[model samples]
Target: MSSGKGGPGLPQERKVVTEIPGPRSREIQERRLKAVPPGVGSVLPVYTVAAGGGVVVDVDGNSLIDFGSGIAVTNVGNAHPEVVRRVQDQVAAFTHTCFMVTPYEAYVEVAERLNHLTPGDHEKRTILVNSGAEAVENAVKIARYATRRPAVVVFDHGYHGRTLLTMTLTAKNMPYKEGFGPYAPEVYRMPMAYPFRSELDGPATAAQAIDQITKQIGAHNVAAVVVEPILGEGGFIEPSPGFLPAIAEFAKANGILFVADEIQTGFGRTGRLFACEHEGIVPDLITTAKGIAGGLPLAAVTGRADLMDSVHGGGLGGTYGGNPIACEAALAVLDALDAEKIVERARQIGDIMLPRLRRMAEKHPEIGDVRGRGAMIAIELVKPGTTEPDPARTAELAKACHAQGLLVLTAGTYGNVLRFLPPLVIPEHLLNEGLDLLENAFGG
Candidate 1:
């Protein structure tokens, strides 16, 4: 392992020199509980001091193998050399003048890159934002403005964001939507093309969604049909093939914009520039984040020029929408995506992990499904004799993995899915090691 506590180029191996949450981490957690509100939750309680490559070094110097790349935000790895260099240079040059106030070249450059990188060769425009939620809100705003419609159609098990409108768009209730009631109006949740649980196929699911749109919501009243090409927080479920294309076609035929929420699956996370490309669907608007700016807070909405330009002047920007440091980081990230062959690396990761995960599934009766592509993969847990969700076992498995120095994330509407989103830059050895830990967790 590269010798270091934290920062880039550290050893890409897991070293559990202490308990998962050692004494130092326990002290920090005690401090955190008092200082931070209870609503702000964390999956792993180990406070991180440094993170790089495939490992995160905790306060107690325990290096854990990362199976979750900060929920897919660090696809290019944390503290990449180019990203660090660009961010440092941009910081020294100037912190923020507010793109809306005086404007800057980095913001425009980031927009241009997004416009070019997103799906479809058609002339497109972009608006940068602070987070994925902001990007989704902006995309919906543009679609509504352009289409002159009030309703937005979302799918079951879709996760947009935590903001007011996005929260309404999301389907989960307990944690995301539970006491937060009286959500935004005119946002409709439709049946998703979930291949594992639902009996409907791709074309059939699309037909049902279309029927609901026309009969229930009225097609003309719909502004957009927003979906995660592959569901993210809702268990990394990849919909049945042909489902996305059929939906996009219906949306286009009805003059409704199809928005692809690529926040979790964009920027080389899924072996492609965007997950929507896997199904050959070109969205009218795409919301991107999580992996856009390395670890920096940056998101974007890129779409057809005509639709994006529909918004009135002074209606599309935010105070810190495109901070220069983040823009420069984004530029560096975009460059590194190509320069380092990160997209190909994601595909290679899938090739190595999927088969191993399948083998693990064969031995574990609790593993009901093994799904996802590239570096974005997951296994759903179920009862031994039936399809009933086994969230308790899923949590137990994750905790076991954590104890063994493998950091894993749990998701799903039922909370029974264990998702693995390793950084594309993670070493092959670490990937194998992480999977081995996961297999061992299944045993216990």
Candidate 2:
């Protein structure tokens, strides 16, 4: 199938006018402060006026090489023509009918695509939601309903969402979970295999973790074990080779559902369509959001049909769940992913980025570790020799990059990991340019 065309086309090259934020953006910021909430923090002072392919043009006419990809949401690149057209057409023809009342074909089609795309050959079903957190919350509900158990297991440093239930599931304390308390109960935390810091290898660490959990919590009492194949907010840490598979086996033996939170690692971000595919292990349930709709707000839980069916006919839906426009945008994203070879492009990005990051780690003693899968990569900053996190240095580096026209994000429980989620469609030269800025930030 040919890629559909719509939305504004990408410019041939990036252009910078005035400084990074420029004057117009500063003016807009001043205006925004008068009306907008103070809770929302501005990263780079610039406000995006247009974006296509791999670049974002701010209101001040400074075109930047987009490295953030809107927090890894636009894997197919910003305003992908096909996605834009599909969304545009969808908006024109009945924007909202409340899928619970008058369902649409696009919703079903998107679900079908997810069922087919997610890891596993077994019969699978899907439930679409508005965001990654909603998908995770619903997945937990399904698991509990299916097993008749109350407790759900999540890994340390694993980030599920910001919702009440997921906040309890999340490992970080400050900002996301601070004072947001009275979180939903029955959520348990377990240590994930952090090879850089752990004493045991992959399988040994997995075994140790499982043993502790089963002994303390009783695996039989747990409804599900949630993990990120490649840790997202927890510094993009990839579980040691045997860790995930071992955990999967334990979950299966204990009759607990294995849930893979692929909100950040799914949809070709990690070379494979799903990060779990690397282990050839199929999770009982997979939660996905970012990159699935190429920028539209859409997320889903794809899982074994039997477990999914446990929920009553009307129990597993939302009023605006699976918005038709978002569904259409998702379908377009899938088409672009396949026809445009985006999966391969993601692999190419990883090939270009990993080596450069590794070299950076070699030169900078502050870089404690460089890790990730595919393009979903990160470099953790430490206080040289010690594993002690250096969030202050991470902040400095990010600020430096931002000033020089690159946008980088910091993650990890300690907030000392610098993650790169550049668009797969970004030109090779532009990728190198971003890397050069990063090198300069590190004192190259």
Candidate 3:
């Protein structure tokens, strides 16, 4: 174990002052269970009192190294000094004038920043929303309006969100979509490149996928083809090298808008500023959230100026879409991301994490595949020497990690993939410490 600096007002060492769900955390959780809806998933039983840099300090004073980044919402780190200060200053000036009602300079400034930051250099426009799902839904609406088509294509095992329209876009169907749909119609599912399990190589895989889509869905009728550059909930699966480019080519030929869902993979989570940059494929539209505003609720859709403008004058926006507070927080987050060299840190994190995960995969036959880009990584667990998934063991392994002070998340259609979304601000030694716990849990 090693000790390193964690911004201001943080401990030099991780101190477990109480048990996993310490007395204070349990008390707060008891109250939370009664007040908050059960639909929201709580990973660990502990309730966090404070967080900064890379550590989550529980109510009972147990400082645990945060590997989940609040589900990748704090890539610039929790309660970042700059973000906190900016949010505080903004809140004091005005809480919510409602951009649609009175408007604000912060909102326009955020939109300008997003226009410059997103993939395309072509003239672009942005629409800020309150959540990733909202951004995605709006993207679909814009695409359908612009293309005058009915069909939307999404990949198998993809997760868009829980909203009705997005649930139709999502592939998984249990808790997110089980009884909730009766989903919106005209969304189609296609196979994504999963090299570890699929038999075909990169180009072949892309060809077969495009062929199937063209044959069944008839590309001309498709309004948009939405994809995650690096599949987030679908086990952190990165598309084969030629896969995305082929799909982009197909979309171009068919007059389909290509939308990149960067909710989890954007803002330097995948080493590159955007995962699509890794393959040099630019989408017509990109949906962003999670780490975009550090920890604030801010999501955006940036796309070709023409397509984004297709919506009628009053068709886009919400009352709280681009609240001043969130816009200010987003600006601070962008500043921190640049000043702290977060994209480089993501690459550095991958260097430490991937090798450790690969070693675990080698020793454990249950680990079917190790994959992902940069800090957004995953290990797909399976029955030894077979393709059969082992979700039971996957859950057990996650529990083991949690017990040992490491927080991990599970994903995949079969729930057999363990994903790691550590904050980019996590210190080298602290990240290794989390990995050491993972190693111990895996019996290394």
Candidate 4:
């Protein structure tokens, strides 16, 4: 694809030099079975030796076009120049002084940047953490502390994380929650405004959610209403119009903190700087991670100053919460996001992908619905002539894409959605080529 050439290091083109899991990868997979637990799964079996631009070079020398940016973690690319430079410099200077131990300027800079970037103009505060789940848990902790309430309302088809509390918050039961109990208590599930499958429209869905929360959990007893503006793992489900605003309004009216989980849709992953911006919903608290720090482990909870400051200083920190290297990486990521005009690039990607996928959907009856915004897009597959989920077909299509050197990811509570998350730096030609491979996979 694209003349089988690359600038330097990892290429920007896809080249299938061997079978999907070539001999080398197969060999490594054997070792992995012994070393790694089966519970920790991977979408692709090929082991990556190096990755950059739009391709991942596996140990077998096959260059696959990356459609899943490590589940939206590498929005700026896997090895962004500025991020690499900052991380290297920080590592050389000192890897860890521990933000909670000695403190660091980069951490403060990152906090300040998040406070300014996340939706909302009012005075805000931020606490840095190590992962999306940590950010979410901390956000709930802060909300509960500020409101002195016990109940936290989440939505059906939502996925927060694998931690005890987040697992309870997540809606999917299979791999995330089934046997993990006893889960954290006080987390209640509500109906989501999924446009494709829902019987109700946006406002009606909001009404149902509000009514359920009011009747099931008393308004005064609820601490927060956590939502993903565009649900990520549960599928790139952008709730119908007017849904988020109504929910936010109801939350405010009831004194329930509205928390937007932008972990997968933040830092230019979506066309906007934040997905909530698309709906004009200003959440009382927001959780961010993944794309926040290139590939480094980092997350944050930015919220209203009063709510954030409610918890005592010592009550909100970790030994490696804001590791200096992660902070430096985050700082670089924020700079790249603005300097490279990545948000605009994300919009451009959405412009290219949405139309292409919609056209593809027209040709394939198996594709039930194509949805999502920006680089974060997905297509839900269904049984022929019906709306029922077809996870088997979804898995088969993903396997076909992988065989053709296109890396894609699957999501949805039913596991019937094919999701894409190309890096912001991917060239247009590479994107087109990847889509071509996907089209061929569909045909096959």
lDDT of each: 0.92, 0.88, 0.87, 0.91
Instruction: Kindly indicate the candidate among 1 and 3 with the higher TM-score.
Output: 1
Model 3 stretches with alpha carbons more than 4 Å out: 1-7
What is the clash count for each candidate, in the order shown? 1, 0, 0, 0
How do the residues 1-444 of candidate 2 rate in per-residue lDDT, one tens digit apiece?
112221346563567667777888899999999999976776687888777677777777667777888888988888888887888898888899988998889999998988988888899999999999999999999999999998898888899888899889999997789888888888888888898878778899888889888888898899999999988888898888899999999999999999999998888999999999999889999999989898889999999999998898998988778999999989999998899998999999989999999998899999999887777889999999999999999999998888787878889999999999998788888889999989999999
Off by over 4 Å in 1: 1-7
- Which candidate should be chosen as best, given lDDT against the real structure? 1
Lowest summed lDDT across 10 adjacent residues in model 4 is found at 1-10
Q: Please write out the lDDT profile of model 3 over residues 1-444, one tens digit for every residue.
A: 113224446763467766787787788888988999989878798776677667777767677877798888999887788888999999899899888889989999999999999997999999999999999999999999999999999997788988999888899888788888687998888888888778777678778878888899888899999999988887888877788998899899989999999999999999999999999988999999999998889999999999998889989999889878999999998887789899999999999899988888889899989887889999999999998999999999898887766778898889999999988988788898988888888787
Q: Per-residue lDDT of 1-444 in model 1, one digit per residue for the tens?
A: 224445465877789988888888899889999999989999989988788889998877789999999999998888988888999998898999999899999988898888888989999999999999999999999999999899999999999999999999999997998888889999998999998899999999999989988999999999999999999999999999889999999999999999999999999999898999998989999999999999999999999999998888998898899899999999999999999999999999999999999988888888999999999999999998678999999999999999999999999999999999998889899999998888888783
Q: RMSD, model 1, all Cα superposed?
A: 1.4
Q: What's the TM-score of each model vs. the native?
A: 0.98, 0.96, 0.96, 0.97
User: What is residue 388's positional error in candidate 2, in angstroms?
Assistant: 1.7
Residue pairs with backbone overlap in model 2: none
Give the lDDT of residue 166 in candidate 1: 96
Q: Lowest summed lDDT over 10 consecutive residues: which window, candidate 2? A: 1-10
Candidate 2: Cα lDDT at 188: 81
Candidate 3's displacement at residue 227, Å, is 0.4
Clash count (model 3, backbone only): 0
* Model with the higher lDDT, candidate 1 or 4: 1
Error of 1 at 212 (Å): 0.9
- State each model's C-alpha RMSD to the native: 1.4, 3.0, 2.6, 2.2
* Per-residue lDDT of 118 in model 4: 85
